[model samples]
Target chain A: MKKIESLSEYRALLGENKKTHNGIDKNCFLLPSGMEKFISAGKVYYRSYDQGILIFIDENSYYNLYYYIEKGSCFPVFSCEKPVLIEELSQNGSRDAYIAANEARLKAAGFGFYRKSFQYEIGIGAEEPQRFCTAEDEQAVKASGFRYDTACYADFRPQIISLWKESLDFGDISGDDLALELSQDEELLTVISGDGAVACTYLYEIVGRDVSEGRHVVTNPSYYRKGLGSFVLGLTLDHLRAEGIKRHYTWIHEQNIPSVRMHERLGFLQNGRSSIQYILK
Target chain B: MEEMMQILKGVRPDVDFENEKLLIDNKVLDSFDIITIVSEFNENFDIEIDVEDLEPYNFNTIEAMWELITKLQEEG
Candidate 1:
């Protein structure tokens, strides 16, 4: 195995391996551009193997590598600067087989299962219901002076980062990483803010042909149960629809019942895809 | 080509893969269907269909998919 040092080399290796394997891992296949950013930031380290490659994000970074070591890939044998989390996505029915095949090697490497999430998707059809905030909720938001709008990262970087850290447990994402993400598109982050406080936020990205993934949605605990979560998510769905996105995808932790219910209430359905994150810390 | 059509139809029985020229752009087939089709093509034709070959233009119609398969086979 050789460490990939340049983006061009990474791309070439990826192409060659795709031909050899008949297909590349979906995460790696879709993440070249993001990899470029992370590489430039000096936050990504990856090594190429015959079956596939293994990517590692810096221990202090928030950029999660949703990568899988192919079924027959060389076992990862590298050391990390800090505790590393390896997240793997597998088809629901194959989850057990996936674990059975890799768990031992992972355990030998001091990694253990961290968390699991269920993947859900909703297709935008002509007759699909348009669910947004109810009239009472809208009135309440207006009365409280809270308004939904696209946030300028430069203006709300501190609050955004603070709220992100406060509300989510994905780990510490560097501000630079957040900046890189927001720089991808001006309208990627939407927020409901009032009186200098960002109450709710939604971040999404176009992941594939006509498909958008809702990457993150968070509401301040102080603003919980005020319908801010639903309001922002509803508007995001509308926004994606207007941008010609036909399918929307999101992942919710298996233990996050409230979030799962919220997504289901808005028409998202489990699509038999789930992922487990393993960490060696 | 007929075998390819059968594979495509087997994966998505309701779609008219032969006539429809926008299987991907029109969102008629999702990612799962594409994965199944790629696996079938690779196994049946003994051709390696790389991720780069998963563009919409190569899968929007039955003819396009057949062209991709033939090209890959010739290369192989």
Candidate 2:
């Protein structure tokens, strides 16, 4: 449990993956604030293994561990040799084999039972013109003092990723180019504060007619209770409904209570589908 | 029309609903706000509104909202 203080050392540990988990790149363990907190009070731990380096940040209350494997799909489904918490935050159609490999470590780390959870696929039917926003919503947005914008995600990828990581269960974010490609979709919506996006939502995969798969409903942590979610999503879904988008569906993690509540309040009924999350007790 | 304004104020008290004509285009009222308002309208007028009718023109002004309600009522 030694501090890997140098940036070069941290990069070498991650093997230059250029990917991020919880706003942490290969270069640093914590963000600027988290780093400062850890430097002052918390302790960063490091251990080298055959497959990769295990970097752990002990922030007193909870510990965050990462195993930067050198090769193979670092996606949880492929490799879980030194597995971390396999929750909704990073489920990517993984097979049982990877979970099987981490059994020893899972037990060693005192991980609890294998519980099943899922990201829901719920739809908004075009039968009712989805007027999901109200004048109160407009007042709420005005009160929050954030402006709504569309198709501007490329400019705020980092902020977007940070917000999502802070709120929703998310894994490795797409690179800048991929982020730009996604934002270019004419239907994407964003709410901006200061210089960057505070929240965003968009649809993908034109299934049939005008129906699409929606995802990435994220709000900045600082702006959570300010009704920004209602404001931005209200604008986006209305526009989507108006676009003759007969139906809009999104995947929500069952454990994400706030998200489920918001979706339900916005008139999305849950479809009967789920996935399993394996744990070792 | 005044009734609709009351409903609008109930959901969002701060907005000057009388002056704001471009509710949708100007980003005054969001989709949730529209949904809240529409749901209120459906309950009050006893009319079913479809997604196709949820256009900006239908919600931009109090008069537009009244016209939409009246039109939907007439259709019924």
Question: TM-scores for all candidates?
Answer: 0.73, 0.41
CA lDDT, candidate 1, residue A245: 74
- Full-model lDDT, candidate 2: 0.54
Highest lDDT, which number?
1
List model 2 lDDT by residue over A59-155, tens digit each. Answer: 2333455555443323222233332343322223222443455444445556544445444443444677446777777666666666666666666
RMSD vs true structure, all candidates: 5.0, 21.4
Give the interface-residue alpha carbon RMSD of model 2.
19.7
- Residue A228 shift from truth in candidate 1, angstroms: 1.4
Indicate which candidate wins on DockQ: 1
Clashes of each: 0, 20
CA displacement after TM-score superposition, residue A207 of candidate 2 (Å)? 4.2
